[model samples]
Structures are given as structure tokens and as C-alpha cells.
Target: MTLPDGGQSPDALRSGTGGGSWDGERSGRGLSEREPFDLLVTGGRVIDPASGRDEIAAVGIRAGSIAYVGPVPDRAAAYSRRTIDATGQVVAPGFIDLHSHAQTISGGRLQALDGVTTALELEGGALPVADHYRYAEDQGRVINFGMSASWSSARMCVLDQAPAVRPQDDPRFRLPLAMFDQFQNGPRWQSAADDAQESKIVGLVERQIAAGAIGIGVLQGYAPGSRLSEQHLLGRLAEQVGQPLFVHARSMAPAGPGNAVDAAHELIDTAELTGAHVHLCHLNSTSGRRADRVTTDWATAQRSGLRLTAEAYPFHAGSTVIGAAFLDPEVLARDGISTRSVIYLATGERVADADRLLELRETDPGALCILETFDLDDPQQLALLLTAVTFGDAAIASDAMPLTYTGPAPRSGTDHSERALAALTGDVWPLPDGLIAHLRTSGCFARALRWLVRDLGVLDLVEVIRRCTILPATILAAAAPAMQRKGRLSVGADADLTIFDPDRVQPAGDYTRLAPSIGFSHVIVAGTPVVDGGDLVPDAFPGRAIRGSAG
Candidate 1:
């Protein structure tokens, strides 16, 4: 829709028309020799959503930023150390995930394979901001990473309850099974904050923001008992710091107090009252068939100067901890779903009734379950809801859950001993079949590209790229300065790019089998190739911390 200024237009960029000539002198080239470049990507259909550029071009990188983007120079081969021939591929800015929960190494690697270069946990951020960043850095992330200050985690921390996970709590920096379980069946999920507890929660939030959180992650849905006043206070704190408030709204029920519409209004009203920028996570899952109505409300809020945005994944069924209170029979009835619709990620079996749900909750409190809340079985209804969110300009996010290993460990003296040793020491192992049971963790972005752009044709290629790149970047840049130079293909922008075969790019996995997508030929993060020729580059850790202004 709105093209970014000072960037090439789609036609000009694609067709190489009506732009400056190849100015070698201006690009630091001498008469006899071209300036050396660290990497050169040649002969690709460069689609820069920010500039509306979609032309064949060559890109040059120096250090970790784009140094040149234009016609390939005659001496380019001689001046560059690495060259990737990108013919027949679409070279675009790497996708930026706004609400990813894939913070672990296995998760990050999966995201890289999906063409993501920057993945942030904004929906439910980490408790200790410093530790979240430090752990990712110390453990060697495969993509740029960051997080917001989690109001939910802060509330649990102040209550002195053991959270499902804590930032850097483990020596190996692993996501604890405790974190996912705590939100479902504990006091943290059931209790409402009083005056003293509310004040302490607010204090923790402020401290986290001061420690470099990009914004405040408010997951009120997990704790329905949390008072609106407590949320309002969190909004005020975010507003005071000029940071956005990323929220997973209170409920997904179709009727009653905690319905999706009421949940949206809660955040909209809070943002209006506190002047805080608020982003709703996973609107498709939360609002279901009523997503269009919710989008209308968000648009109305924006008209009134309430800064509101929302995101959605491509899938219809949404996953969460099995023991979440919202899964209670009364709530599920209000939401119009049943236990029969509940699919357990660990077993891939649909819970047959209340008895089965209770059995799973009692036996496996930490297991993740998928609720078939939307019209996933109907193609037309699915397309309509998907189109509604994209029509509203909602950004795409995976809400990717972390992949965990529960199988037997590798033997000490086997041929796979090295792999076993790494797994033992690194707190990670090959993802079990159950871990990749859902496509959301590994195929969300690619699925969005396939379903929205290639299949339904709801959006053109450039528009989809904009939503995944510049749109999310623009939203975060208001609070996180580190994002300003990202999500674009202009000179001086970070050399994070995803080169894929647009014709072949599609999600490969489904509810039955989990697999990574194909066609992502190259994924570059900060000038280093993390995924080369459709395979992950072993031991590559070019990702850096994306801190906020507070840091």
C-alpha cells in the first residue's frame, strides 16, 4: 500500500528503470579497481519491501551492513571474497518475527531454516532482561534475538513462586519445564494481585525495562484473575518509558466476561487511558471467525490515536499448556470448542472428552495441547479469516513454542558420542517426534508466504514481504532503536537477507508430520550465512543481541 520513501519503487527496482545509473565512483570504486567487499550476492530478483523495489540486482556487503545494492560491477568478482549466485531467486530482507517463543537453540535453528533472521519474544517476555540477552549470546544463537519485560513473569517473581522458567536460571541456559507448567495450574494463574502485590509487580516491570527490555509483555490470558487495574499500571509504566506493550489478551471464549471481543477492548481501553502502544498477539487464534470484527475495533482505536497492532500465524489450531484454566469445560463451552477438538502435541491424539483432558493434566501438566478453535477443516472459512488479518495489515508471527527433547540420552562410547556429548553439555538434544508435531514451530512464516501469497493470492509478494519485514520493524523501532536499520534493503541496513525460490517456497509439515520448509536457499544474518544451500551452517553464530534504549 504505502511505499517507503527514498527506496526504489517496485517496478524500477524489478525492471531496473528510472533510477540512478551504476555509479561505481560513488560506490567507492577507483578507476582501476573496485572496492573490496566481504560478500556479494549476484543476479537476484531483489525485492525490497521498504523501497518497493523488485528488480534484479547485485548486493554487496562489508562488515555486517549493506555497502552496495545496484547493478553488478564489472570487477565485482575480483573485489569480493564470497559470491552467492542468486539467479531465479527472490532476495528480500530477512523475516522479523514479532511474537516468537522459540528462544532455545533448537528453536532458533528451526527459525533460521524458516528464513527468519531476527526472532523476538514479545508476547510473553523474559523476567530478567539482562539474563535473557546474556544467555542467548553466551550460548551462541543462530539469529539475532531480544525480548520484552514480561509482566506475567514479573508478577510470579514478586509472588516468590517458582516460574516455569527463569532467565539464566540453569547453568546451560535452557528453558525450564517449570515455566510452561506454572502458568497452567498454580497460584500464579489463579490469584488476583492486591495493593502490595500489584505495586511489587509494577516495580519489577520497571526494573526489567531499565535492564534493556524492548517493551512490556503482558500475558493476561494465562492469569485471568489479574485485575485490570494491575494491567493499567503496567501500561502506564510502558508509556512512561515510551515502549510498546505486547499483550496476549485475556480470553478466547466466544461469550461472557472473558470473550475475545472483551479481551481486545481491555487492551484498547488501557492503551487509550495510559497512552501506551499496545500490540495484540495471535489475533486469528484469539478471535477465530470474529477476527474481522476485532480488526475493525483495532482500526477504530488507531483512528482515535490509540496505537494498536496485532499479529497472526498461518495455522488455525493454536497450542498452549494443557492445564491452562481457559481449557476448563465452562470456558471451553463459552468458546464453542470441546475436548474432542483438543489435540495433544506429545501424543498427537485428540482428547475425547473432559475425562481425557483431566487425565492429561494430571499425568502430564507440562505437555502442550492444540485447540482446533478455528475453521481449519474448511478451506473457504480458513482463507476468509486469513485474508481478514492481512487486509487489516496485521503482521505475521509464529508464536513458536520451544522444541524440547524427552527421549533417552546418547551413549558415551558410540559413533554418535560427539553429538551425545554436545547434547548432554548444551542442554539440548535432537527434537523428538512430538517436538516437531506442530508446524507452527518450524513452518509458520513459510506457510504464511505459501498460503497468503501463493495460494489465496490475498496479497502480492511485495506486500507480504512488507508485513513480515518493514512493518514489524517499524512497530518495534518506535521503542527499540536497534531495529531502526533492520527490515529494509537500503544501503547501511544490516546484511540480513533471505534468498528463496519464490515458486517453490511452501511449508512442508502439517498436524501429522513436522518438517522444515524447503526453497530457503540462503539465509544471511549480519553478513554471515546461517543457512547455506538449504542446509544450516554448523557452528555458525553470527546473531547478536538486539537491546532497547534502556540498555
Candidate 2:
């Protein structure tokens, strides 16, 4: 519930057992009740993709779920409630970000401001699942989130004891066997890997699932052949538990042998062997046929009745740690790629000379690099591919990184993070185009959807909304038992509708290679307006964590 000033209380909350909350709900000890729904949004084209309803409608919200959805209710006469005019607007279920590196679902607020109602965290899922639930409840969040287990994430916690964890080698992956092998055997503490490593890995993942992770996320790209057995085991366990696998298969760039096809099929093989659901992360990152092959394989498996799905972001270049092999001509040429095709991102120094890259790779393997591989194309073609691949089953993944917000603000002048500092002694830099094309400059959801509906002409309003809403809601519900009231535009669905001027809703994505970070206007979450017009309302963290199956 919302506090008087349109925020959640800082006090601890606890929900009782059976149909219990993902996190506990606090006793409304001292505060007066909120006005049920803060406002009523009416006169808009309401599109609930989950159920496929597209028409002019009115939505009533109370305690965060749609109190009514169809005919407009009296506003001035209906007690004390605010009224929102939605003429010429598009009212649809809020979006969902299927993949991200979130430690806790509470981090979903970043997405809510962008109209994302759900954020699913990947890797290592929710170790100590209780804490993840608490973070969401404590925030009185506007959006919802789900957990995914990461083999790499689990290893860092139960095994190493850190708040954060990534793959052994640069998990974001740049390819090359020498670099890839580290994830498999792991650089010994010389030899015997404590013998308990495998057990710990399994136990950690199992616990994350038990805690609340709905699925597994393997950045197979970085782990290479490292955790194959464990991943196979994870797949087995996920199947038994009915959780999907969110895999960042091998490599996305045209690098080495690890394009989307290679990594995805391998995971598919594991799915075949273990009997589980497998999802490919960021399908469009590769170019031309390689990207097509991934969707083809995914389709074949699904049609054959092997549960499989994939996710793709709207951006062209991907962001990973900045020290990957995209800089090495040897690696590039192998993929039929080149340096000119790669631009450095999240760093300040220019890329190193070929000789320097070899020197660095040999000397230091942990170096980071966020490369923007230039796979430039007609926006129309890009949208078409996304449409062809989604299969109406695919979900949208913002791939919106934490550093994008927590990283020094764009106006900070100079990068202050340690990673940025480290890359400086060497030549690394934030790609020029990234700061623009990524929608970092503005809100991103509309542009992402526009690519799907308008440019690609793949889907109309209904199907796209379904991908963002009911589809993700179903996924979240699979994780948290309390989320039955989420994702759809039903009477009981969470009142998380976004209302925007349809004509004015044209994409604001400034995707010219030089200006990626631009977006759109009007974002509402959980019956609350986190972004009015186009400004982020600070102190508005209304996100909730969604736990997974206990069975």
C-alpha cells in the first residue's frame, strides 16, 4: 500500500503464511489509509496483450490492482480520487525487462521509471532469498521482479562470500579458447579445486531456487566450457522444479566460434539431456545469418515440443566489461570482424593498438571492456528480425545495466569508477555512439516498442503488450505465488497500466550511431506516477520482489 505522500513506508513489513507475500507486509500501525487508487486513467486505447483486448477503455485502481477496467467511472462524484485524462492515449500493461544483473528485485525501480512494471534478475538468483523479498517490500515499489539462479553468482556467494559475483574469466565474454577455458576448469589455486567446489556450486544454485529464483541464468559466453557439468546439473534441477533457464549463450558478437547458435544449441542439448526449459538472452547481438540461425534453432526445438524461448533488446551494440577480445584482430578476423566495427564503451581511453591488446590479454585477463560492435543496418530490417524471432513468446529485456544509473552520471565530466580509472593507464574509452544510440539520453521503452510495432511492423499494439505484460507476468507468477494479481489488465491484475499520447508516443530513441541514450514520456507503475511528462520523481521506489516456487 502507498503512504500518505505517495510512497512506501520505511518500516518493516511482514505478510502472514499461506498466500503469503513475497516479502512481509508491515502492520498499518500509525498511518491513515491511502485513497485506494491514487487516480483513475480513462479514455485511452487499452491494450492488454495477455488476454488480447484492444479498445478505448477506462481503468480503475485501488490498493494497486485494477478495481475496474472497461467503462469510465464517475470521478468528481466517486469519493475523493484524482482523475487522469487519457484522450488519444495508449493504455497498456506496463513493460517487463526479462534479463538483467540485479542483485535484488528492488533494483526494479530503475525500470519502473521507464514504464517497466516487472524486472527479472538473472544469475545466482536469490541466495538467501529472504533478503531479496525484504528489499522489494521495504521499498513499497511500483514494479515487480523475479529471480534467476546463476552458477557464477552462486559460486561467488556460498563459496567466496561476496555481495557481487561474475563469471571466472570476463564473463561477458570476448571468445578465444585460452580465455574461455578458465570458466571450465578454473585457474586452479594451482590444482585440486577444493574438491567441494562442485558441491558448493550445486548447493548454492539449489538454495537460490529454493529461496525464490524462478529460473537459471548462465552467461555461458564467459564461463565457456567451465561449468558445463554443473550447468547440466542446474538444468536437471530446474526441470524438476519447473523453472526456466535464462542463458546468455556463448558470444553475441561475431567473435570466435561462439555466436548465438553455438552457445544456444549447446544449452538446447543440455535442455534435451536434462528435460528443462531454455531461453536465449539477447538474440539480435550477432549479425546476419548467425542471428537468424539462433531463432531457427530455437523455433525447431519449441515446435518439436522442447520448451525454449529467447530475448532481444532494441539496441544495436551490446555493453559488457570493456576488455574483451573485440579489440584483437585475430579474434575479429575469425568472426569476419574488425576494429573499425568495434567501439569502446563505458571507458574513457581509446582502444589499444593490436600489439597492446595482445600484451594486455597476456598480462591481465580480468580487464573489462564494453564494446559496441557496429552491426549497423536499416532500422526496418532490424525490427523485422526482432519480429521474426520473438514468436509472440519472446520477452523484452532492457539489458539496462546498473552502471548506467549508478555509474557516474553523464555530466560527471570524467569517469570516477575504479574500472574506468584502471582502463585509463591503458587506452580504453566510452564509445561515442553508445552515449547516444542506447536510449541512455532519454526514456527507452517506447522506442523499444516502436521498433517492434511500427518499424518492424511485426506486431500491432496487442501482441507487443502481451510480450511485455501477461507473458512476463506468467513468468513472475511462476516464481512468486502472490503475483497472481499481476501482469494482466484484468480486474484483479495489478493496476500497473501506462497511459501515453498515441500520436505523441512516437519513438524518441535517438539511435543515430552517435546518440543512443534517448527515450520517451509518461511512465506509471503500480497505480503510481513515477514519471510525469518526462521527469523522474526522486524518492519514488515502489518496486516489489517476486519469489519463486517452494515446491
**lDDT (Cα, tens digit) per residue for candidate 2, span 1-551:** 52221222233112322122222111212111344345667677878765566777766666766655565544422522776777677788777677654322223433554567666666324444445455446534445665666566455444445443222323232111112223332333112223468677777777767766677666555544454676677788878887787776655544345665667678879888998877777666543336666676777888877877766666665655433433455755666554444433334334556665555556544433344543346665555455434644776666654322224534444545544433211222332222222342123456555665777666666776666666655654554564556666655466666666544444343323232212324566676776665555555655666666663
lDDT of each: 0.76, 0.54
Question: How far off is residue 499 in model 2, in Å?
Answer: 1.5
Poorest stretch of ten by lDDT in candidate 1? 16-25
Model 2: residues with Cα > 4 Å off, grouped in runs: 1-38, 74-80, 102-110, 123-142, 156-196, 251-259, 286-288, 324-330, 346-352, 356-370, 378-392, 404-444, 506-522
TM-scores, all candidates, are 0.90, 0.74
- In model 1, residue pairs whose N, Cα or C atoms come closer than 3 Å (at least 3 residues apart or on different chains), thus clashing, are 10-52, 13-55, 14-54, 14-55, 164-178, 164-179, 165-179
Q: Name the candidate that leads on TM-score.
A: 1
